[model samples]
Target: MDETSPNIEADAPPALDPAQQSLSEALRVSFGILKIVMVVLLMAYAFSGTFSVGSNEVALRLRFGNYVGSPGQRVLERGTYLAAPFPIEQIVKVDTRPSTLLLEDEFWFETTKNDSGLTRSQLQFQKAGPLHPLRDGSLITGDSNIVHAKWALTWRITDPVAYLTNIGSKEVAQELVTLTSQQGIVHSIARLTADEILRGIVNREQMLGLIQQRLDDMRTGITIDQVTLDKVSAPLRVMRSFDAVTSAESDRARRIVAAQQERARILGETAGEASEPLLDLVNAYSQATELEDPAHAQEIETLIDTALLELKINDSVIGGDVARVMNKAQTYRTQITEQIATEAQSFSQLLPQYQLNPRLVMTKLWEDAREQILTGDVETFYTVPGQLELQFNRDPEIQKERQKEQLRSQKKAQEDAESNR
Candidate 1:
């Protein structure tokens, strides 16, 4: 083991005896010498602290259980290497490549959170899983129900040493994961109702999140790619009711969606009503711009007038013979105009007469018109210009009828808006 051992050379080649020596013999001796030299060189090479690493592989040099070198230094890139002698150091090869593991656990019992919220309640009715016992998973659902669950955990070695320290070994990791994954899945399952597990959607991402959180709390350096819902079966007693509730839920969802759509329709009408004034304001602004372009004033005013007329028509609740109401308004306006025109000339001649006894004629007319406009005679006195007074009659039935008509109109206006959109 000393350095001097390599320095010592083998004995000089023995002298060839002339009688036994021949061409082949001499040559053989020479070849043997060369072989010995080659061997010596190989031995020296072997002790030079060299190793090999494949293209997809890495290596670590350890001296007395402590890391001595990085993954590869004197190691071959993708070929053979003659490592240092055993007493000096050793090499450990690790395949830094992608790999997969299919692990599973069968948990017959479930650990659940207890009502005290301090300790969890284990499902004594359920049986313990075969892999390992996961002690800290308990959940209660919206509906009262409990069930045991187990799971499979597939993981990879992200950090070899960490994995070693955390999960111990791949086999150990699988075992721990079998127990923990089962526990986690059961915990989640127990927390949910049969409907949530059955009809409810268990998102893969959420499941993974739950799994990863528990693993992190335990400091297990692992990542969950997915958590598949393998099966969801309800307990016997409420199974039938659960199935019925599913149908009712679907019907309820449909009703909700329909209601939402109706609400949207109503909202569209409400928004339209609010926007109408904006439209009018824009038109009015355009009309006010008449000072900027006198030539366009008539056009702007025409647009405003058209918009007002349209709005008025829209406000009138026109549908099926709505033209009649519009015609009535127009006719009433025309009659008022005609009556005023005729009365204007008469009023000029009557101004002086009215100045003297204006009340006399109008009082007489009002008295006579009251009889026609009213019912169930009630009389009234009036101060007149040409007479002592004029009598007036009022009727309660007519007044009540008018009041009823007003109330009906008010209710009709407030009942519901006409759909504008």
Candidate 2:
């Protein structure tokens, strides 16, 4: 046992037999193949995590089952993207395009035998009748009227990150959108009456706006495009009766409008014809006051009669207003006749005295006229017995000339009579 021998033994390689050498060479080859296999598997695992986003789709990348990007940076646009292998990072592709959901509401009827509900086919099999409260799904209007309604909602994903994170998937998001939209529809229908919906008075677009506002409040990244109604009507059983009532109402309205138009036309024609006569009648009444003579009363009465006659003729076109005018005019005629009779009585009393003494009656009439004219502090001057005479008449010579003319007229008349003889 020498130190040199021990050192040489530790440093020198051991001698192998042929069988041992062959086993050693096989082990090296096996390790190389195993390493190559592991590299291939790892490369396959990393490649397996890659995904593609379409033009209409957005890819959301998640690391360790959690989202990896910020609000704005979370979404991957239309391109191929690579992430860490599965279990480290995951990708979910969501379609951001518009989608539609159709919702249908059915009407149910009740019979004596079955009060639960009647399907459409069952309804067809039986006779049509009123719907049952238990079977039918309807909106209870403000006026307590019930109506069946069906509509569809169209929506699209606007914020992919919010949509993906909040709603999980497109299918789930659609379901949520439809649910909220239906709620909005029910809310809107509750505010309207059956007549408003049936008559097209309520704005359908406003309903869509309400549904959209609901969706926005939910923040499910769903944008409602439209809300379209498919049906709005009363129950099928009473539809015919409803139509009949509607038809009757429309007919009544039309008849009322036609009657109003006819009335306006008739009144317009009568007014046009009677306007001038009515004006003349008013003027005649005014002139009667100014004339101050009972002799012209008959003329004024005749004018009123003529005006009433014209009104009666114009009013004859429409039997209604004409009868009224005729009755009023008859009353007016009676009043006029009575006034004329009173005036005639006064004239009759004066006529007898006037015939008995012309000069005395004339002088009395002149004195009465002076008394009526000299009212309210008026002065009367009569020059008598050597008092200073007040002669206001400067044209006394004109009166003398009038007397001379009268004599000339008598002379001319005598000359004409002699010539004729």
Candidate 3:
């Protein structure tokens, strides 16, 4: 009885069979399941969201609709990171990539007239609260013609949050751009004529920037890249009048250019005419010198040229040059005489062109030299019969000898005629 009672140990609860072991394992599994549940509760955190930021993107985290923190200039390059979800924290993704968008504004166009005499149209005159187009509006021209214009604007969002928050959405930004641009263009068009706008690229750009300024004042974070005229279509009713004005401008430009060319031609002609008298004087002076006119010669021409050149010609040099030239002329005359006497031997080859004998050729040349040496002016042509008669009287001996020969020839002719009789 003592040994059996020792077998029941106080510290040991039980010695189970296979059924007990199976029951213990089932309880163990239950405890492990409970531990897994606690771990899941600890791991699944609430109020967290994911951030997918690209290489050029940044995420601005907000808490309770207020700015909590924002990524710096460099983007949070890794994509899809978890963050405190919305309501506790909200993440706004911003694109830093270069981008652009274009928007066109709605504005008033041409109108129809009513009995009230005001410009009106069914589309523009119809009232739709704030959405009605304007009528009787005008567009400024470069050349003062009333033009109709519409614009296309291209812009970029430089700051995404600022753009989204301030401008509201891409749709709202577009609407503001269109409206602001229309207002600016219309106001500027009032200051100019339609023709001015048509011919100007730079002017249109400046006006577009003015429109952008209107939106920027509202703190819209959009940067206008450019503004362009989409079209300058005109009202069909005023086509002829505008065409007439453009034609007049073209005519004015043509006439102005023609007048300038004519003026240049006249100036050139005047310069040419101004030099003609000097050329004539030089030619006349050359002919006189060739004839050995005593008052006009190459020395006098040289003196005149030196004076015109603003150079000095002293009396000693001028007188010495003239005397030396006269002496040289005489020596030249002797040599020419010797040559002519030698050439007179070739009568058959030389005399036929002149219808003269070799002796007559020499005699004619001698007379020409005599006229040249004594003449006060150029040339030795006879003009009237009386002057030729006077010239013959200067040689009395040759005349008397010719008269005696005429008498002898006449007597001899009479004797021969008597023999024939």
Candidate 4:
């Protein structure tokens, strides 16, 4: 049986060689390893499409140069997404965050990089030559005045697909936005006066709106968040003149405010809260007078008088100087009326008494008048009936009393003056 087995083995391809067997085994293991490596490579190739979208960014997947998925699903927001690998598909990420673009010297006078540190005077001294129209950038105002400005623009990609399709990249979008904003600024500043621009009267909101409109018209898929005028000024040659004009305008505005304040104060002191209505009446009356309408003027005057009367009668109404004057005048009128009536009554009674006895009444009246004259603060001279010569020199005591009276009058005048003040 053993001899037959050997013969059969010898016949079976003369038995496989050890080296060949080992070589065959190694070939099998290598093939299995190669298959596993191929599977891993395929998995790697498939997962290579995985991408992360940032919180502030949107992603668009394009397959064969065309966007994938429906219109609404095309833009991928903050998350992980997978698409076919390159050549078959492309992942386009768009930053949706607000991007700032500072446009400096675009509308400014021609200046080199070294001129940045120069002051206005230094720059003016260095560039003393006439402006180069081609080199210099400027905006013409409504007043036919030239001005320079620096601007800052904030923008964002609102429509990712549109942005990716139309503008393509942030850099290209920024360039387009900047160019459009410049055009918008030119159009906007042209409508404003030089003084308005230099004095910060630029309508940035309007400028931004116009720029956004322009972007929309161009289908740029970019929206302007803000347009800021960082700096604006007239040409260096006329800057001082513009400054002077600006200063004069500010002074004029200040004077107008001061005048308004003074008017308010005066009105408040004249009639308190009623000052506004009183002023309205006064203004209407003045206007009527200027128009030569006497009837209207008279009507306004009557209304003013009525308002004044009501203010005086109603104690609840806060009265100012006008009310105080009216009260004083009314009080004086009452006092004078009472005094005149009492004097008239006294005169009437005396007339009847005088009619009853003329001589007696006359003597009595003379005595009463003499007594009144003696009681008054007057210098009285007395004479004896028989004495022909009277002493011309006054008494020392009387001179002393007169001096004392003069001192008292001076002191009383001083006190009255102080009280009035």
Candidate closest to the true structure, highest lDDT: 4
Task: Please provide, for model 3 over 1-421, each residue's C-alpha lDDT reduced to its tens digit, 9 standing for 90 to 100.
Answer: 6665665467687778999899999999999998999788656654237557777666666678876644343224447767676668777776555444333223334434543364324332343223223444445454555555556666666666667568656668767776777777777666665565555543766676787788778888777777767666344455556667878998999999999888656533332222233334466688887787857766567655663333223321222223334445667989999989777765456568457566787887789878778675333345665534444324566567778989999998677544432
- Name every residue pair that clashes in candidate 4: none
TM-score of each: 0.44, 0.51, 0.47, 0.74
Q: Supply candidate 3's per-residue lDDT for 354.
A: 57
> How would you encode candidate 4's per-residue C-alpha lDDT over 188-273 as one tens digit per residue?
99899987888889888888888888889978888888888898877888777777887998899999999999998887677777
Q: How many steric overlaps are in each model, in order?
A: 4, 0, 17, 0
**Which of candidates 2 and 3 reaches a greater lDDT?**
2
Candidate 2 Cα RMSD (Å): 23.0
**Candidate order, TM-score descending:** 4, 2, 3, 1
| Stretches > 4 Å off in candidate 2 | 1-15, 106-130, 199-202, 246-421
The models' CA-based lDDT, in order, is: 0.55, 0.72, 0.60, 0.83
Q: Mark the 10 consecutive residues where model 3 has the least summed lDDT.
A: 311-320
lDDT of 2: 0.72
Question: Where does candidate 2 clash, by residue pair?
Answer: none
Instruction: Tell me the deviation in Å of residue 270 in model 4.
Output: 2.4
The model with the greater lDDT, 1 or 3, is 3
User: Per-residue alpha-carbon lDDT of model 2 for 333-421, expressed as tens digits?
Assistant: 99999999998997788899989988998898889888898764344556778758576854566667778989999999677544432
At residue 347, what lDDT does model 3 achieve? 48
* Per-residue C-alpha lDDT of model 1 across residues 235-339, encoded as one tens digit per residue: 333445666787898999999999988865653453333334434545666766745765566665665455444533334322212233344467798999999
